[model samples]
Structures are given as C-alpha cells and as structure tokens.
Target: MTVDLRDRHVRAVTPAEQSPHSYFVFADGRLLRVGAGSTRCDPIAEVPSIREIGPGTGEGRESELRLYVHGPWVCVTERFGVNAALVNTATGAVRELSRADYHADVSSYSIGFLDRGGRTLLVAQTRWNRLDVFDAASGACLTERIGEVEDIDYFHSLLHVSPDSRHFLSNGWVWAPVDMVRVFTTEAFLTGYEPTSIPVGTAFGYNWDRPCTFVDARTFVLALDDEAAEHPYRQLAFFDVPGEPDERLEPHTLVSCDVFPRNEHGEVKGELHYDPESRHLVALTDGAGAFLVSPAGEVSARLPDLMVGGHGGQAGWSYAPRHRVFFRWNGGSGIEERRIQDCDRAEP
Candidate 1:
C-alpha cells in the first residue's frame, strides 16, 4: 500500500509558505499545511468529488494525535496513546493497527512507514535494556531486532528513521536537554553492529539541540553543549559525521564555539541556523544576540533580535535545497523565502 510522493508532494507544518508546494494530503482531499499528530492536509485538487471517509471503529474521537507522515498516508494515534490509526492520503481510508500485538497495552513510541508502500514499523521502549517492534501488515513483531535492541541501553529513548531509511538516531525524544545523542547506520543497527560513541562533551554537564539537520546522504551537522573530555574556552561541540555505513563515526571536523549563556528565565538559549548557500551557521545567544559563522568557523555577521522575538530564528530559517533559498517562518505565521545575502533584510 505504498503511496507515491511525487515532486513538491513533501509535507511540512511549520513553514506555512510551503503550503502551496509541499503538503499533507487529507482524506477529504484538502491539502493543508503541516501540523502535529492530528492535522490533515486539504487535498490539492479541491476534490469536491472525493467524499470524506468517516472515522471507522474506535476512531474519530474529538482529539486525534497526528504523529508521522509518509507519502500520502498519515499515522493517527489517539489522546489516550493506547490506540493508533492510519489515514490514507489518497482514498481517505482509515484502519487501526495499534490495537494489535503488544500494543494492546503499550502505545508505540515511534513509527516509520515505508515510503513506497503503507507498511507500518513501530518502535516502543521499555525498561532501558529492551525495545519492542510491531510490524503493520503482519500484525506481529520483528522478533530478531527486538532481541538485539533489548541489549542496548538508550536513555529516555525515542527512535527516528532517516528520510532514505539508511540511518537512525536514538535520543531524548521530546523537549529536554539533548544530552546523549547517537547516530547509527540504519542497515547496521538492524543487522546488529557493535560500535563506539563519538563523544560530544565532557567536563561540564549542559547540552541542547536545534534539531540535527540531515542535509544529505552522508553529511549531517549536529550541535550540542558540552566541554568534551577536558577542553576549555568553549562550551559547544559541533560534529560532522563521517557517514560511511560501516566505518566508525569519527569527526571529520569537530568545531567548538563560545558558550552562549542560557537565559535565567528558563527560556531556550543559543540557537543555530545553517544557511547552506553561504555555507554559514548562525548562533543566537539569548539576552545577547545572533552571530553568523563561516564553515571555516569565523564570525561573519552579527544579527539583531527577531523583529517579533527577543531572540533570533527560533523556528526561523531552514535551507530549502530545492528552492536554493532560506525558508523562514515563526509559529503559524506566513513564511518568507530569502537568499542568504538578504540576511540583514530578512527577520530571523
């Protein structure tokens, strides 16, 4: 049941400007901007002819948790977390998969759907030493991988599969200090590979993340707060993963930056924005301001607070590789597309 996601068919929720191009398809045929766990896209065609499919058994309560989107299908779970459903993007079809397997009692912690078909893969965490996987079509477990995962202890674990399904990461899932982040080759992990961790920090114990950007098949940039073994003068560590599937993930260029002091009010501090075009990265230190740095690690520009924010791009700009520009947006506001040179002119 794989759904083909053709050109501009990608889904997004934060960058509202992506609405016209990237989209989330709904059962009712409306293509809407992206939202978490329960939002449906308004189908692109204005398909008045496509009738809305009403909720099936054990579904369509007042609240729906729209978790992940793959192709045209969206994984919908309920507020109770015990139940899960998949809404077909094309036919508006809905089915319940969570009610089966070990999920009769445990809600799945993370989900992955094969992009070409609608098969569901779920990951659930329990008791640190073990994890559970439930297969959608088979309504059972991939017992082999489950036994392997149980031997690895990932703290406060959550699972994420890469866009190409080649790599995955296990770390703190929600909003908490991103302290122990680890990346693994998707193939190696499933096939059972032993490895050493690429250290991010040591010395002092403070860390956070702006979401690791998976820029390409082999190149991704990760930001974290740490002292790293015994280094002084810097509190941040940036690691560039070697990305060879079987090789150790040693840092090709592990750069560190001056510690951006956190806000005493508990607000998040020191955000990073990478503009691929300029090959630049921006760090917005709360209460202070923002500074743009070159790939060689030199400060290039100092930016002011976001016009509306006392800080810089919170959910600010992401490099739109397709558009060759920066896509900037805040909350539900409209998005702004800008060239990297237009930094001073654009907000965040």
Candidate 2:
C-alpha cells in the first residue's frame, strides 16, 4: 500500500483525544471535555473532570497530577503518593480511588483501567514486580500478581493490554535483566492470581528493553534492538504466543528501518505508533517526518515536515475516524487539520 503526502497538512495548537461527541484535552492536573456546546474552529465548552481533591478543596501542583483516559473513564491522578479517580462521560460522575501503594519508582510504566467483557470496572496499576488491579467502581483492591518484568522502574517499560482483552504483556530490564518477557491473563488478574500463577511468554525473548505488543490473541509483534553499529535501525519481530503452557517461544524478524534517531544526548527522540486502522506502524519523531511502516514492519512512506509526538508527552494530535481528518497542535501554533481520503495503505 502507498500513502501520498500531498494530501496532508499541519497546524499549531494543543492536540486532544477525539471521542465521537467529545474532545478530551489534558494538562498536568486538569482534563477538559469539549463537545457540541458551541460552533467554532475548536471546542467551545469545557468541563473539568476533577472537581475536588481533599476535604472539599480544589488545589494541587500540576507537576503532581497524572492524567489518563480509557473509554468513558477519565483518570486524573497524583503522581504516586496520593489520590486517583475515574470521571464518567455522560453525567460527569467522578469516582475517587486510592493510589497509596502504587510503587511509582524511577516512569516508563503506565496504569490502565481494566474492563471485563465490555464493561470497565477495574483499574490496573503496575507496581514493583506485580500489577495491582483496583475496583474502579468502589475503590477496592480486586487482585494482584507478579508481572513480566522483575523490576519495572519509573522510566520506560512496556505494558499493553491486548485489543482482544485476552492478555497483557510487559518487558523491562531493571528487575532480573532476563531476555524473557511476561504475559498474564485479564481474567486471572481481575478474578485473582497467585505468586506462582503463570501466564504465557514463559520463555519469550532473545533480547531486552525492546517494545512489543499483541498482534492478536495468540501472536504479537516486537521491535528488536538496533541492527547496525554504524547506523542503528529498528528491527521488528513477530512471535506466536506459546500454545501449550510449556511450549517454548520463538520470534522471527519481520522488518527493519532506521527510523529511530538520537538527540544530542543520544537518547531516542521519537515514539512508535501502531495505527490499527491503517494496519501500519508510524514513527513520529522530534526530528524529520513520520515514517509509515507496514503491518509487516517495513517503512512504506515518509511524511516529513510535520510535527507530532504520537500521543507522547501529552495529547498532541487527535484523529477523528468518522471525519477522516486529524488535528495537529504544538501549544504555540494554532490547530491545523489534515484530510485523509483513506488509510487503506494500498500500493501505488
């Protein structure tokens, strides 16, 4: 499939997550739900999901608040040592919860609200080597168990709930520094689990610190380490989730691209975004343009001169599928709209 850059455009403003009828924009300690309350270039009506923090008082440092949204639940939380809540969409009901023991150490980990079937009623917060799932509806502990990483620190680690909701996978090097990645079930986690309760990916890796995700219920994709010493490239691998509980795991290289660039500090300056709609993986960078990678993990197109951090740092871009358009923002520049005729990724 092929993508033409000539059909795209850019803009300058803050980006947001676009739900069907609402535009969810976030700041440090704040979340604004914008919707059909007005008619203009941007969202007119705004609702602060956070109403109160402590004893009817509304005050806190932006640096101390962490914001996230899942389905109709918008979570505005304290960095580590305090409160967390799930904000409802329709009636704006706020469900407050506790994040007291969330071992938010040194920041690569993420917390997600877990849903059973189609209902989201639990919260999953990654702690030391285990994940603590809380009752989002009642602010109670649902369950907890050992995770893939021995030590998932405060910096970059990988944990993604599968789209199919069957499994959740994670990988980090801080703990045992082993090549094996971890996978656990959503049901076992929501229901309950033991210390020795095993999931899958029992022996799933030949590398470390690489990002991976579930391709389906029984298969997944991983970005292996760099290939060249002189010019580094991101090599991707595909592996089948172990069939039997004791089956050995195997991963084969699928594709590679030198899309990862380093900053002056030599740190990776971009983030990889998987577009399920296009079946393409996009590398959005702090330098250069976006490299659209195929499902096979090959770089297919490069749309340069555009500013995007995927959903990194904060919400910087919002894609509206119904409108086939996306908005780009950078805080200073006003919002720009780009039209997408199709993201079919068809070959020219």
Candidate 3:
C-alpha cells in the first residue's frame, strides 16, 4: 500500500494533558498518555492506566513509559524507582511486575512485551542486571534471574520482538563496554532459556541507538552514532541475524544529505519506520527531510518542505491490512491518517 503524503493533515494534542517526555499509541487507535501531568484523555478505561511503578530520584522523574500491544490487549510499563507494573488495557487492572524488593540498587531498566501462544508475557530488566517475566493476565512471574552483567547502567539499550512472536532481540553492552545484539527465543524461554549472542562483529559498535522495526526476522536497522565521538549520524546498516564470522556492520553513508551531513561528530537525529509489507523504509530527521528508502537501500522519495523534527521520539506509521488506511504519527504529538491510493509497485 502506498500512502499519499500530500493529503495528510497534522494537529497537536493539548500539551497540558501530556507528559513532555513519555507518550505511546495503542493498537486500537487509542493513545496511551503519560508523564507527570494529567491528560484531557484522562482515565483511559480501555487503555492501560499510568501509575508510579517505582520510586524516583527524589523529585519523581520518570525514566521511561513503554506500551506493548498485541491483538486487543495493551501492556504498559511505568519505571520510576525500582518497581514496574503490567496493566491490562481491556480493563483498568494493574499488577506489580517488579518492585525495589527484587533489585535493591536498581537505578534503570527496560521492558519487552511479547505474545507467546495465547498468553501475553512481560519481560523486565532490572538495574541490577536481572531479567524477569510475568504473566500478563495474572501478573504471576514465570521466571527471574540475575543477568550476566556487572554494571547495570551500561546495559541501557532498546528491546524489540519479532512479528512472528518467536524471537526477542535486544541491543546493549554486557560484560565489556562494546555494543552487542542478543537474540532469545520465546519457545526456549518457556522451557527455561536465556539469550545467546549471534557472533562477535555482527552487532554494530562505535555508537548505536534508536532501533527501528525489524525488516524481517533476520534484518533490522538502527540509527548510528559516531565511532569515537558521542555525537550521532545519519547512517543505516543491515546485519544478518545469526551473523557470519568476521562480518562487519558498517553504516551506509551514501544516504546522508546536507542536513544529515557525514562527519565524525554528526548524529542521526530523527525517527525511522520500516513498512514490512511494502518493504519501505521511511526516515524523518531533524537536520534532513523526510525520506523514503526502498528495501534495497535506495532513495525513493524525499519531502523536504514538511521538515519537522524534535527529540525524534516514537513516530508511528503502520499499514493496516484491515482498514487499508496508512496511519502515521504527525511529529510524535498527533496522528495523521492517510488513505492509500493506487501507485506503481515497481522499485524507484
């Protein structure tokens, strides 16, 4: 399905009811609001309720709020002190998934939501380097363990699950300071399993963050940062899952533009979306314009007049097979629904 960018309209949600930092959209077109402020879309009955899952650093600054949706259910994770919750979206039900009792010194964490068979699973990573899973319906933990990490803070990274719900992927640092991508199977987890690293050089190193969706079970893309510096760059790289030995994942610098300059200190400040069905990759950058890349990594379209940028947070653009409407998030603050019209499927 090809979306017409010209027929789109954009609007911002009221800022008073939103948290300046945290926001998420549910699968059913309902928005899961967050942050320290109250939302006009308050008391989201059919959506997950936001509450202080853990203790904060005195002033109660929330670290992260993530919403995971599968089918009709949405699971929300609110991280504060050392606790988190797995809430049911269909009903206003909340259950504590983790607390300070699990990891005393846990100062940071990440959560991944996956649907295994007919059940929903909530996986939590504590600041003390521990991974735990809980039943989404009952909040009963199925497994827990102290992960293979000495310093938990360095483990800060992104978590993504496969479309098939068979594999879970995480990118972060473990024993060493080098970046690593680890894959775990849901089937193995049910029988007491842990993630295994693909290979040595398969994971992108130097600097990497902001993971886009999985192009397939084996291919995924991430925004690259400079190798030696802390700055980010407008570069994309593709690596085979279960990577081959000596395989080096390098950035595609040809995609960079004048706004997204290729420098040792430039960062890829924007949002990325991968359309699985059409094999289209859309990149919205602060410095550059909105660009569409073919599955082969060739530029297909660029909308420079609609240059919009921010922290380049979560921007939604998904193909609704049922509705036939290509939905997109307008600047991460509002949504723009566009009807897909007839367009040539030939590669541009």
Candidate 4:
C-alpha cells in the first residue's frame, strides 16, 4: 500500500485510528483523506477554520496546530495553549473542548484522545507537571492530579499510552532541559492521585529526546544518542514499563545501530514505529535511512539508502498497522511505503 504524496505539501497529518491504509491530512487548503496503494486525495470536509489556524497559516504565527486522530474523532490542539477542539469526521460535528487562558508556553500543556475508543481525553502540563483525564463526550474532568509540588516540575512532553491503556510514558525534560523518560500506571494515578504523595513511574535519566513507541502494553523502546562520547553513536534501548514507580529500573536490553549519516542537527533524526502483528520495531531516519529491529535487540533488516524527510515536529512519519507498512514523505516528490517483511522477523 504505497501512496505517493510528495506533491501534496501536507500542513498536518495523522494516521487514521481504524484504517491503516488511510491518513487524515491537511493539504491544499482543506482536510483530505490520503491513503495507500493510490495517489488520490479524497476530500473529507471543508475546514476553513482549521486550515486558517494551522502552521504557516494566519493563526499559526502565535502557535502551531497539532492533530490526533482515532476512529472517527480528530482532536485538534494548539502547541502553546490549552485551546482545543474535538471533531467527529463521521457526523461532521466540531466541538470546542477548551479555550486557552493566558499562561500557556512551550511548557504549558497539550491534549490528545487517551484511548482507541476516543472516550477519554488526556491533558498533560509540560511546565507545571500535572496530568488530567477528561470525559470526551461530556467534557467533564474524569481524573486529575491534585496537591501540587512546588519547584519539582516533570515537564511532561510527548505522552505515549500503552496499547492496553494501563500505563503511559512521558518523553519529556527537566530543569536545564535534560531529556528524561518516565512511565506511569494509568489506573493508579487516576484513582487517588496527589502530586506530592504519589510515586510517579520510573524515571530514566540522560535518555535524550528522540522518538519512542510502545511495543506492547508493558514494553517500549527509547532512542538514545551517546552524543558527548568520543565516537558518538545511535542506540535503541528496550525497557519493561515498570509495575512500580522505581527510578532505578534500567533497560533490560539495548540495540546498537551502525554508524550512519546525521541530519544538520548532528543527530540521526527520525521517528520510531512498532508493528503489533509482527512484533517488530522500525526506526526510520531522514539521513541514515531505515532499519527493521526486533524486540530482542536484533537488526533484522536495514535499508541504508532510504533518505526520508518531513519527520519531526508537526511532520507525519507513521506506521499503519492495518497495512503493515510505514508511510513517510520521501523529503522530495513522493510518499514511500516500507513494509515490514516477515522473512526478516526475529524472535525476541
């Protein structure tokens, strides 16, 4: 299922929750459905308001608009403010979820649908270090962290909910901006959370910010670059999503990648995706190319010549589980699909 979207000039894109073959993309001044195996961009609806607020648009100067899609629901949010909206593509209904106050910043807060069913919404504060869950339908706060901790900010950034919806991981930073990763049990935190009293999940120090994806409900992979070392290298570390909030828990295994090219930022810039059916991890990079990695720290397949683009920030580089293929902008004139081959599958 390969779809060439190089000419589309996508402003924002997110993988459709149910259909791996299709993606919701904002391009050509409208919201359209771009899918695999074909190059046609199907029109969904005219979203003039959404388009105007998106990056590079009139309202985007102050903040960037991000999209999160699951099933029939699309959650739109501003990168720097709490203002958010939930759109139902099925019914063509748009609902304003929250309006921004005045105190939002890079570390303010962000919103996303918490579960696959789109019943819950997750509100995480990047600067204040608070997490809140809300009822998507009623717009009611379901659970929230109470009793704030002064001067101890977790600065939660990219939040990854486990496949089972039992836990979540925050690939965020701390003071002085040290990239740290933390995991938390969803039920425990939501049941009776007190920020000062609760033991937040295990915190891993020095794991610089790259992209990470959950392999399963209890396991995930984190990207690491030994940048300060004499010979810098890229590595992927695998960890069991800790059952308790133990800060000392370390990655059970690590996969060392071949020394490869780097982006202008002096890093192997890319995104990580996991195939649940094949149980494999795929790391796609713009400069160094892509690799098919197993859960057991094995490099099963490597495509070194594949130069990718449109990977970071609001750019979309995603793996569609339904088609078992990776969809990414070629950074040129095409959207390439990299399918995970079964013959290359390695046992973990």
Candidate 5:
C-alpha cells in the first residue's frame, strides 16, 4: 500500500540548507530559517561574506556550494572541498576552513559536519587518502593526516558520522571503480588508537554513491545493487559495527527492495534519511519520488513524486524527528514538508 505523508508547504529563496529541525536558505547576504512545521521564513541573520572560494573551474565539481545546518551552526563547503567555512547563524560569526588543492573528480574530496550537533567537521582528502578532523565551533584542527599512513588503496569520500558520534562510515570507491563501504571508531581514529582501517562490505562495480543512514550508534543501513562477488542484491543492507576490535563486521539483508533511480552508469540517483521516531527510512529517489521503507524491508507508504532538481540542482531531503516530517528542497523558491504520521498504519 502506498501512503502519502504530504503535510505543509513553505517558500524559500534558495534550496541551501537541510538540518534536523529547520530549513535554512542563504540569499542576498542574508540567512533565512524555516522551522519544520511553521510557514514563517524568519530572517535569522545578516550572513557575513561566506562566498564560494576555489578555482571555480566547473570541471568536475558536483555543486558550487553545499550547506550543512545543525541547530544554530552552519558549515558551507565547496563541493570539491577546495574551500569551506563554518557559520554560527545565531552570532553571525564565521570561521573559514583551511583550503586544499582542487581535484577533478568529486570522490577525491568531501566535506561535512561529522556529528549530529554540527560540532566536529571532517574533510576527506581522497586524493591523498587522508581524513582531517576539526573542532567546528573553535576552528581548531582536532587531528590531521588520519588514514594517511595506512597502506590502503581507498580514496576516502562520502563520510557519515553515527548519531552518538562514536562511529564513522565512509562510502568511498577504489581504483577498479568499486564502491567500498567502511566503518570505524570515530574516537579511536581521531585519538590515534585504531589507526588502521576496518573492513566492512564491498559492492564491486555497483551502487556507487548510494545512500546510508544510521539506525543508532552501532548499526547503519547501506543501499546497494547486485554484485555476486559481494552483497548480491539490489537492497538495503544493515551492518553492525563490531564492539571488539577482533570482531568482524557483516552485512545482513534486512529487506529486499529495488535500489533504483540509478544514473546511466548505474550510480546512485537518490538519497536515504532515517527517522528514528517513526523507525522508517525515507528513500528519496530523483525522478521516482519517495518511499517509506520499514527496517524489515516493507514499503509501508510512498509519495510518487518529489521535486528532485535538475542536473546539479538535485533536491535536498531531510527528516525532522521533532515533528516527524520529511522536508524536500528543490533548489528553487519553495520547500515541501510531508508528515509521516500516516506511517503509524504500518506494522511496528
């Protein structure tokens, strides 16, 4: 059965922000905040000069600007990690991140807020095979040269820090162009405890840039396509991080579903966001709309159409656990909020 969770609609100047409880839009030197269920788009602050810094070569960058909003904090990073800045929406203070040389392929560089509070920042230098951690608020380099000395062939990209901020997941690819999903202790790596990379599941030559969301501090869900040599299914696989260093990480197929909306080369054409309150993964596919999939792999409900932007203007989808709603921004002048209360009809 298809369940539609359409709730309310709000207007925005730019589809620039996706955080937990609100939508932030940056336009005309101003930052606007839209609460999850409110129609008011309040002008939060006169945003300082946080411009896009880079060669702007437009050679292989994904988008000119990427916004990560967490509570009152905002981090804007160039798509290729050439430059970035951390902004406090409440105070109007800005901290510019250290710049790096541009790399053509986006998989070469990634920048994002590592934890749920937007406190820790991570810039993956895939070209150098190293990860840099930072204190987001104070602009202090917490640690550098992480995974740099490891004798591995993985170009680390697509970082996702767990809810408790204990584990870190990287959906990076390798030379043969295979998508390798890895998990490790976030604290251990930053503190020089477990400097070596821990292995997770690998999907050879399939499911590159697919979506992943953490169910908790120790378990995460990963999307993948069929690859007989590895996880042989177009499904969402749940994997648990080993508690002990000697334990092994394994992928368990919680449910079977199509990993669709793939591009020409069969890459990810969608995103996955988990709502802990409702206990469902919101699968936002580019052209195919959105689906509410349970952890047991059942399609509880679906909204058949979501305005996922064109080309580089892809829609940003996020869930507000406070309101139990999924927000979709299409880089235009409006945002959509869909309530998942109808999902209660699905089995718990």
Candidate 6:
C-alpha cells in the first residue's frame, strides 16, 4: 500500500507542529504529534484536542522523545536534563520526577525508561560518572551510585536499554589523543557491584559523521572510514560484549563500496538501523538508496527508491507476527505510508 505523494487527503499541521525538538509517533500510529520550541502540537487532523503537557523548561536541549509504554501508563522524558514525567493519556495528568528528590547529583544528564521485572524503572546517569535508578510509578529512589568510574569521559553518545531490561548499554568515546569507542553495561556497574570489563576493543575513533546502532546484546552496526581515506566506507561488524579477550568478536566490513552521497560541503550523510531478530542491518544513504544486510554481513536487499534524510528520520518495522505499519517521510512536510501488514521476519 504505497501512499501517493500528491494526495490532498494529507493533512497539514499548524505552524506550532513543526518543532524539530519533540516529534513523536504514538498510540500505534493513531497519533502523530510534533513538539518544537516549547509547545507540543498534534499535526494529524484525526486528533484535534491540543492538550498541553507542561512548559518546556530545561537546559541540555531536547534531542529525542524517549516514550515509556507500560500497560495503560505513558511516561515522557523532559525536553532536557534528567526529568521523567508520567502522563496519563486517559486523564491528561502529568507528574514530574526530579533528580533532586532522588538525592542524586544529576543536574546535567539524560534518562531512559526501562521495564525491570514487570516494574517501570528510570535509569539515569550524571556528568560526574554517577548512575541512579528510580521507581517509575512513585518517583521513589531505588538505587543510587549504581556505578562510579574515574577518568573515562562519556561524551553524550547513544545510551540503549536491552529488551530484557536486565542491562543498560552506553556507547561513547573516551578522551584521548584519538577518540576511542567504548561500551558500558549495567551488569558491570550496579551499586555494590564490581565493574566487569567487557572484552570489546575500540571499534573505531569518534567520527560524529558516521551512523551507528546496537543490534542485540553483543552486536553493533556502524559505518566508518575503514582505511582512513577521504571518502567514508560503510561497514557492519558484530562483537561479543561478555566474551573473553581471545573470545572477543572480530569487526567485519559488510559493505566496502561507497553507499552515501556528499553534501554541498562534500560531507557524507547517512543513517543506519539494525533489526536484532533477523540480524538485518539497513543503511539509508543520502544518495537515495537503502541497503539491507544479513547477520552474516551480507547485503540481502537494496532498495534504491527509498530516501532517508539525517539520523532521526529512519524507521524500523517489527516482523514478529507481521502485524505492523511502515511509513516514511517524503520531506520535512509529510509522511508516506508504505505498507500495513504483518512482519514475520523482523524484530520490534
């Protein structure tokens, strides 16, 4: 089911809906909302009630929306900082979970909601190498000082919680002559817990231009300039996070050819997404091509018609029962619904 680009049925959101800060797809696609500047706007004509959640007051700047969905409750992170807010869509009640109440020095940090053993948990990390956990429902402190490490600087890289909620992984670069890639896990750093060093090496130096994402518990997909040449080459590598030094996984280059195009300034622009279930890696190139890779690092499918812009515009389809939807943005203005069917081959 390919949606036509010229369909007049497409709705235009109000000027308020154009916020690049807090756009989200919620309610299983029934709601398409955009929150930018300070106000949240419902762009779709289907949901007309514009209920204000709260004022956007914070510092770090809202990068993405970390929506925690458990049963009937939905919690959203603040525009910036370590603020977890609980919002009931049924009643529109909003509750703020502040870091001060938890007795943790988390003035500057980011948070993600995790579901641990059927209970909602808030996982946060501070700039000074401190981790904290809070009860999602009551905003009560669960654990403070989960882990403390000195000298390693976590420069705002991607922080991901595993599907099982048993571990949290952070990918960042340590401050050195050459930026080194490092991954930190919750299993190695809980309070009263001894830090266990994973046998993973510096995958690559920090190059903000390249795109990267975790595939599963021990695997990651990254695009890098393998030869340190002018043009960047995209590659996919899998590593064992908990394996020994000799048992550590080796990095493999899946794609050796040029996959992305250069911008007006001659900089390569690309985005990547990996499906852990199928071990399928999708690379959306700025040159208008999408490359699908297998777990064994093989290109399975290459769709040249798909155009993915930047890092945040890419979407993944779950293939458990194949009961999911596929949509893509045509530009900054609208989205095109691609397919609505069951995905029996991908992960959620």
Top candidate when judged by lDDT against the true structure? 5
Q: Which residue runs does candidate 3 get wrong by more than 4 Å?
A: 1-42, 45-64, 78-83, 99-109, 145-156, 174-178, 189-195, 199-208, 226-234, 243-264, 305-348
Summarize candidate 1's per-residue lDDT along 83-125 as a digit string, tens digits: 4455555565555543332321122234444321345565443
Count: clashes, candidate 3: 6
lDDT at 330, model 5: 40
lDDT of 4 at 347: 29
- Tens-place lDDT digits, model 3, residues 238-347: 64454332333443332332223334444444556665555677665554555566755667666543233433443434333323333445533345444322222322
TM-scores, in order shown? 0.53, 0.64, 0.62, 0.73, 0.75, 0.58
How many clashes in candidate 4?
0
What C-alpha RMSD separates each model from the true structure?
Answer: 9.4, 8.8, 9.1, 5.7, 6.8, 9.5
Q: Tens-digit lDDT track for model 6 on 1-348? A: 222223222222211112223333432212334433222234231222211232234233323333444433455543233444555444555555543322121222345557767677766544423456677666676655434544333343345555555554444444451333344455455443213333234345534325556666556655554544564554444554554324233464454544555454334446666655455666667555666656555556665555554345443211111212234433434443432122223222
Top of the candidates by TM-score:
5
Per-residue lDDT value at 144 in model 1: 56
The digit string of per-residue lDDT tens for model 5 on 1-348 reads 211112322222223344445567554444566644444466656534444333446544333555665556776555554555567877777766544453333553455556735465654342435566766666666765445454466666667777777888777766675667767687677766224457674444645456788888888887765445444455777888887773446786556786345566655556787887668787777776667788888787776644344334444555555466666554333456766775444342
> What TM-score should be assigned to candidate 3?
0.62
Candidate 4 Cα lDDT to native: 0.58
lDDT over C-alpha atoms for residue 120 of model 1: 53
lDDT scores for all predictions? 0.42, 0.47, 0.47, 0.58, 0.59, 0.44
**Cα lDDT tens digits for candidate 4, 161-248:** 6777877766666666566676677666666442322222333344444567888878787776546456435376777866556644
Worst 10 residues of 6 by lDDT: 316-325
Query: Candidate 5, residue 271: CA error in Å?
Result: 1.0
Order of all candidates by TM-score, from best down to worst?
5, 4, 2, 3, 6, 1
Q: Tell me the lDDT of model 5 at 156.
A: 68
- Mind giving the per-residue lDDT tens digits that candidate 2 earns over 57-146? 223523234455666566655443345556665456666654334334322334565567556655444444555666655566666333
Question: What's the C-alpha lDDT at position 234 in model 4?
Answer: 37
Which has the higher lDDT value, candidate number 3 or candidate number 6?
3
